[model samples]
Target: MSALILFDFDGTLADTAPDLAAAANRQRTRKGLEPMAYEALRPVASQGARGLLRVALGLRPGDPDYEPTRLQFLEDYAAGSTVHSKLFPGIEALLSDIRRRGLSWGIVTNKVTYLTLPIVEYLDLTRESAVLVCGDTTAHSKPHPLPLQHAAREAGFSVERCVYVGDDLRDIQAAHAAGMPAVAAAYGYVGEDDNITTWEAETCAHSSTELWSAIEPLLPSDLR
Candidate 1:
């Protein structure tokens, strides 16, 4: 049977850190603080506004300044979300290969629809993806199985016939909870301290170039 491949949007399918970091840095600049290095900010990109705000301003959710600052940061991000965001090297080819193999693919992300759709369009994946499930698309996000389960159902695949790929530990957790196999994207913005080995993915792809090899083995013989 043909299989379904579901991917996380940020860090997995696209290198979105440059633009995410830029928004965080803009917050710093407005406060007369020098912007943090891109290298430092990139690691927390997957964590979204909460992570970026903490890094850029040392502010956490409950802090008095956190909510307003987060709003501003998100506003800044929405304005230029696609400016520096692009698919990781080899990703377009990888998606094409999946299609040629008669497999279907979709995106399941914690990114909200408003924020996710624009980038998906910018990367020209809007028409090609079999389904698009966002944080708001379900009641819960990653680390919860709802989003992944929703994606599989929307794409007409059983949970066992799908594979989830992402760079975050939560992605693995979600896939496991959904009764699907998972692949860790080691090339993505895995935080500096994260050890991908312990994420318990069925296999780990060190880069987009290695992804096909890692994923193909996890598929049924016919699908492979």
Candidate 2:
């Protein structure tokens, strides 16, 4: 059977932090909080809304403004989702390869549905993705297997015949919990000190080119 490749959106395939960081700063400015630098927010791109809220608004879990602040951030982000977002270098080539090889591909991200749709569309990925499982699509998000498992099922692939690639530890955790082989995207938003080697990844691809090289062999020889 052919292997199905499931990719994480924010850090793995796209650089969406610029728009997200801009939204975070906008929220901060409205709240009279100091704006944070874009670089500072990059690492948390895959961490989702709450993490950005914490960095930009400084809202604790119990803070009364937290929910409202998060809502505002989401609204602003939706408007500016693709302002600066783009696929990583070599990603187009890799995606082209996947399609040319007739391999199934899909996205499973912790990004909420509304925001995720715009970004995916902006990247022109709508026609290419075979399945999509957003953060709110399932009851639970990453670090939980339900989303990935559900995505695999919907894609008509067994979990064992699939491979999930993502940048964060939680991505690895979720893939493992879902009974799929996981790969760490080393070229993603990972910090220098973050130890991806410790995770139970099938392998780590340091760049989109490297990811292509690694996965090409796993595909059928005719496809390769």
Candidate 3:
């Protein structure tokens, strides 16, 4: 049997924080808000634009300007989508290794379908992904079992045979909630104050190489 691997797109499989931060800055500049550095934005990259806008522009969700700022951020992000987005180092090697081992991998993300499709295409990863689940594909997103369960169903695997790898607390929560094992991606944009050790996961991988190593032991015997 082939073990199913589900990955998060933004911070886990791709280094999209820079481009996201740039978009945030663009919106901030337009709003006369201070431009925040990419480093400062990295930790909140997986939280989506609302969280980022709040962090960068000091706007709360209930604020009257929040929606306008979010819309502006979306426009800015769309304009700069491919400018600085790229896969993390050694990711290609890790994917190749998985292919070589005959394991199937998929992506489950809370990112909107429009942005997710283009980014996957831009990275030349569409052909490589066995399954792709976007935020709006179903009624619920991550932290809800719907997305991961949906991915497993589409990939023809039992949830128990799958492992979901992601960079955020919600990822682990969702995977576990879905009855699947989880892997925490340590190299992702998690903050210094974040408690990775508290996240419930089968294992943690600090880099692409380490991820591959950790995954190797879990590969189905058929592949070995």
Candidate 4:
């Protein structure tokens, strides 16, 4: 077992916003509603269908149409998984550096496996990641710590030696709840209302270079 660096997929590791925004717009078109601007949907991309539904369709969980619309949104998203999904700048180099440092890294995401696995494969990370844990991998997901804990266990890392990096507030909550440190990816899809500075993260990486600097020290020096 070694020190582990785990990431949330959507905004943190990969920029899936383009495809998500497209899916949201597709839903709007189906509903005969005007498409929402991409800028408006980008911030909520990390929140998945619920967020998109709220923004593009204005459908809340309380509405009868919420569940069906959410399902349709997911369906549309799955159909366009890799169309515009790509890792953020410097991510490939970061992964290479992590490998060179002899540390282990993986993805722990709220995205379901059916949707996430294909994207991971398309990104050619299926062979690179030490482990890949999705929303359904455990009984519960983020904020409950099950997903992060599952990733650590599967990756053969100790809770104390694990660091979770993510773009959303729930990521910080989950890592801390699991007794692990969390790094906030400030360069990611941080919403207009979110305050990364106050997320109680170990550190907030405002850019990929900053992320590398912040993460390098958290990794065991021996591994580096």
Model 2 lowest lDDT segment of ten: 215-224
Best by TM-score: 1
Candidate 2, 92-209: lDDT as tens digits: 8888788777788999998889889988998999897889999999999999999999999999988877888899998999999998878899888886668888986878998877
TM-score of 1: 0.98
Q: Per-residue lDDT for 126-203 in model 4, tens only?
A: 877999999998899888888888888888887888888999999999999998888999988988788888899988
- CA lDDT, candidate 1, residue 26: 96
Listing every candidate in turn, what is its Cα RMSD in Å to the true structure after a full C-alpha superposition? 0.8, 2.0, 1.4, 1.3
Q: How accurate is candidate 3 locally (lDDT)?
A: 0.87
- Model 2 segments beyond 4 Å from truth? 217-224
Stretches off by above 4 angstroms in model 1 are: none
Best-to-worst order by TM-score is 1, 4, 3, 2
Worst 10 residues of 1 by lDDT: 215-224
List model 3 lDDT by residue over 123-224, tens digit each. Answer: 999887889999999899999999999999998998977888999999999999999878899999798888998997778998866887766655455654
lDDT of 4 at 209: 59
Best by lDDT: 1
Clashing residue pair totals per candidate (backbone < 3 A): 0, 0, 0, 0
lDDT score for residue 157 of model 2: 88
TM-score winner between candidates 2 and 3: 3
**Better structure of 3 and 4 per lDDT:** 4
